[model samples]
Target: MASLAASLRDPAYVFHFLTPSFWSFLIGVVAAGSSLFFLALRADEQGEHFATSHNRDQINEAIRAMPEVVASPKRLADEANQGRNELIRQSHEKHARAQRAWARSQRYKVGWAASLTISALAFVLGYAWPLAQLSFFGAKLLP
Candidate 1:
């Protein structure tokens, strides 16, 4: 209780940012959170680490995409039927891929969530020190 109060009263003790302002800890939280979000986004976009993405793209390109050398359908009905089938298949494949990506991203999202929760707790503790003494808690929790 005294040290934080003293630091607040004495400008010299509170000069450094990392010591009190927690810039370094905040930076780590940002960096780690950004990386986790990126990984999650990447997974959601394309399951590069999994076979699902490769196969899905390949099938979509092969069957759904119109080729340069196009052929006229003997009957309009044939083209319509093929197009409908392709659309259905593509939608199913996309949904499956999305599910896989979402499952894969669970861990990253949880890690980021945990980091934020801990950071918030630490922030409270850092500011609450000068108001109340919790040496018993601090002794075990803080360095």
Candidate 2:
């Protein structure tokens, strides 16, 4: 047991501790988590858009239900049209926000995939390459 501990302290063997694979894997996991978080945010945004649309529909319905005694016919028509235009504008803005959130989630997903690929390549170079060198030449190629 003591000999095993002593061997672990050797510089060449300890090189494994400093390998890029561990760092890259951590980054990959963080990126994947970020992607998921953004995806949830995107869903929230879409739900907001749906709520906005519902509100707009309700506002339009209310405008249409206004009594004839409220104002002149032409004035009431103009007011109702204005209300509808405003509601449509608000709905469009909410939809735009949802689309932007979706775009952000997609970017994070791509980053996660890239980080994982880099981690895999780093593992091969940092761990496998050293072992191969040690087996064939009785010495590692890198520190």
Cα miss at 43, model 1 (Å)? 7.9
- Badly placed stretches (over 4 Å) of model 2 are 1-5, 8-77, 137-143
Who wins the TM-score comparison? 2
Write model 1 residue lDDT over 1-143, tens digit each, in one string. 33543456454444332254455456556755666675666565445435665666666666656543335664655565676567558857776876667665676666657766666666665555533434434322232
lDDT of 1: 0.56
Tens-digit lDDT track for model 2 on 52-118? 5566567556656754334568777667567556655665675566566556656655655665565
Please report, as a residue range, the 10-residue window in candidate 2 with the lowest summed lDDT.
1-10
Native-referenced Cα lDDT, model 2: 0.56
Error of 1 at 45 (Å): 4.9
Give the per-residue Cα lDDT of candidate 2 at 22: 48
Residue 2 local lDDT, model 2: 26
Cα lDDT, model 1, residue 83: 66
